[model samples]
Target: MVVQTESFVMLSIVLFVLGAMGVLLRRNAIMVFMSIELMLNAANLALVAFARYWGNETGQLFVFFVITVAAAEVAVGLALIVAIFRSKRSINIDELHEMKG
Candidate 1:
């Protein structure tokens, strides 16, 4: 069973758009961070689809690097979120901006 590249690309686009909406519409810092991760995953999906269609290993290799970076991003992002929540007792972005010095 062969899947078409267009299908994967379309799914990626939909996921990316949903992620963008989540980032824009949600006021919670954690939600925005999750949406950003979703966007990254969508891009990774597109990259893998293109690599498979082109019969090349480059995109797959690039995905490994992306995943590595994403892992680091997750660690740092979650740590920040935890710290913010501890200090503010809230993860609302609007409330965070009031902390401007």
Candidate 2:
């Protein structure tokens, strides 16, 4: 019932890469937001693994802060998405240029 640090780190890396790809390749705003969340979770996973290996609570504690910031980000991000969709009728990022003026 033991897990290897390398295994966890590798998993984290894979998840982060997948998230990054989604963000880079997708056009939908919601999809990109979910991808960002995925990346954050992957980072948190790695942090927890390292904290466990080091026999310390610091990583877990930092994860809590990350979670808090994520919550705030979600609130603000969703609000902005809604506002943009209301006016533009689409969540496509390419439409963002209209707001430049």
Candidate 3:
């Protein structure tokens, strides 16, 4: 059981790293946002796994908080994305640079 839990955590960590890499390397805004969500989900998975392995409820509570925050973030982010799309007609991260000034 311990070995299985450890392997699950390792896999989740690898997936989180890949998602981080995708967020860093992708130029598309939507893809980057999706990658960020993927990373969050991966962490949630790890937390739940650890909670089950250790027989603790704290990890589950933490996962709940994470999910709440992720939901709020996605809502606000998508709204902003829509506004940007309406103004610029493009979802590319590079195009957003012009808005800095």
Candidate 4:
């Protein structure tokens, strides 16, 4: 039997939920950031799937832009994390309170 778009959407939803849970439950800053990225990727997958199903290019174009932004975010974020690690010697969110100032 052929798979349906609904099934794909459901899978994406599950992935998004898992990512959200991971972000909420993890204390490590890197793991939390990775979870957020996973959530973004899940949304991108759903958007592309929906675009294909509806015969529209806009959603796919939006996903491309989102991916570009995500890449930039990852680059900048990693740089910041590296700086923080050098100063703090740890990547735990709890130890990052000094970043507020």
Best by TM-score: 2
lDDT of 1 by residue, 3-101 (tens): 999999999999999999999999988899999999989999999999999999999998898899999999999999899889989889888666566
lDDT of 4 at 1: 20
lDDT of 4 by residue, 1-101 (tens): 27777887888899999999999999998898999999998998899888888998998998999999999999999998899999888989887675564
**Would you estimate the TM-scores of all the predictions?**
0.90, 0.93, 0.89, 0.89
Where model 4 places Cα greater than 4 Å from the true spot, the runs are 98-101
lDDT of 2 by residue, 1-101 (tens): 19899899999999999999999999999999999999999999999999999989999998999999999999999999999999989999866775654
lDDT tens per residue, model 3, 32-59:
9999999998998899999999999999
What is candidate 4's CA lDDT for residue 101?
45
Q: Write down the lDDT that model 1 would get.
A: 0.92
* Candidate structures ordered by lDDT, highest first: 2, 1, 3, 4
TM-score of 4: 0.89
- By lDDT, is 1 or 2 better? 2
**Deviation of model 1 at 42, angstroms:** 0.6
